[model samples]
Target: PPRKNSGVLADAMENMATFAALLRKEMNAHEDNDHEYRKLEIWTRGLISSLDELEQSWFAAAFYRKSVIAGFMDDMSPVEQGDYARYVYFYKDGFIRVFSLLDKLGTVLNHFYDLKTSKLKTHFSYFTVLRQLQLLNVHPALADQLEQIKNSYRDPLENLRKRRNAEIHYMNSEMQDDLWQRHQGLHDKIQLEDLDSHLEDLKQSLEMNCKTLIAAFSYSNEQLRKEISKPKSVQS
Candidate 1:
């Protein structure tokens, strides 16, 4: 059965569409700024697609998670093992995409606000961009809002980041728990972590991601409209 899409995902998609429409309208109105607006348009499109993929991965993970009833590897049937593997795959994909989407947004914000984050580092991340926002004191309202969102979800985001690093650099994230268990004492079978709790954390992170995106694009849209409406003498 197809899982129902989350409202958070749906709202983000809707807001992105509105932002795109406004951006195109502004692009046509302000011919002198077409180049900058065009770049923003491309990034916005990419964000929309990336967000859709993240939601799909999350849904697939939830679907597979429901099929696995075993508390430990020793009690699982072969089918349950396969289901758990699928769950882990999609879960990992979901968390990795969460950061990937944010970094892509960082690129957009960097160019949109002329933050010059690239000058600070050849390759910078979303967190770095956030820091630049604070350091530069550009768009203080947006920066404060984003900072609040990040801080509110700090614990979950940190957990996801550790899993992401482990999955990418060390070993499969799920296996990290198993490795720790082995250090505790040799066991006949591996115990499963709290899958539901982990998924809940991922869900919270996704909500945080959606809120950050909305805050950013909404503020940008307002600023763009103000810039467009200003008299030619006042326009920059």
Candidate 2:
């Protein structure tokens, strides 16, 4: 059976579809020469509008949809209806949800960037691999990136936690942006290629990352298949 978080995951997946539509709308709406057009600086960025006010703008409609839709519903509960609701996502279990979302974002990022090696200084790849394998294992083979993710993003879980805490506590988006600068570097690397040939080396290197991700998960995917088949509680 699927896990209990299926609803949350489904809502997110549907929101991704909506997000894709928003991207296409924004792309078609913008003229190529427009200063604010989201140029193809990065694969995903190319999909977003150049407007800064539209952060996570793709889900804006789903965020406020009035009528409850069928499989596509992402309706928030009464607890999340108020302004102070942001804090609700910072509690014990709430934090895990937030982190899981980050891992998902990382998976999305993986689709757009070059091969990266994890350089986690504080922890070993084994633990990080297990966590990613369990939670955000979008590609069973993404486990190869686990070494890089763990090694390179040694303390991503903690760093993201701190950044999210500051954003929630101080009402400032600075620290978060600062952290994002590192990711922006990855995007910057993509633009160094010849714009005329239409292919960037970094863009081409994404295959390495995908191979790593797939291998990482496949390392243990078969053994876990049986465990998942039996009626069992989600250990995490």
Best by TM-score: 1
Per-model TM values vs. the true structure: 0.91, 0.23
Model 1 residue 160 CA deviation in Å: 0.3
- Cα lDDT for residue 182, model 2? 48
Q: Give the CA lDDT, 0 to 100, for residue 190 in model 2.
A: 21
TM-score: model 1 vs. ground truth? 0.91
Which parts of model 1 have CA positions greater than 4 angstroms off? 1-7, 29-34, 231-236
After TM-score superposition, the amount by which residue 5's alpha carbon in candidate 1 deviates from its true location, in angstroms, is 6.1
lDDT of 2 by residue, 1-236 (tens): 42332332333333343444444554565443553223223323322221111122212222332222221112433543441223222222233333443343443433222122144323323344345444555544454455465455334345435645775687543334434554777443221112111112111222222233343333323433443345634345
lDDT of 1 by residue, 58-171 (tens): 888999999999899889999999999999999999999999999999998898889999999989999999999999996999999999999999998999999999999999
- Deviation from native of the Cα of residue 16 in model 1, angstroms: 2.0
Q: Against the true structure, whose lDDT is highest?
A: 1
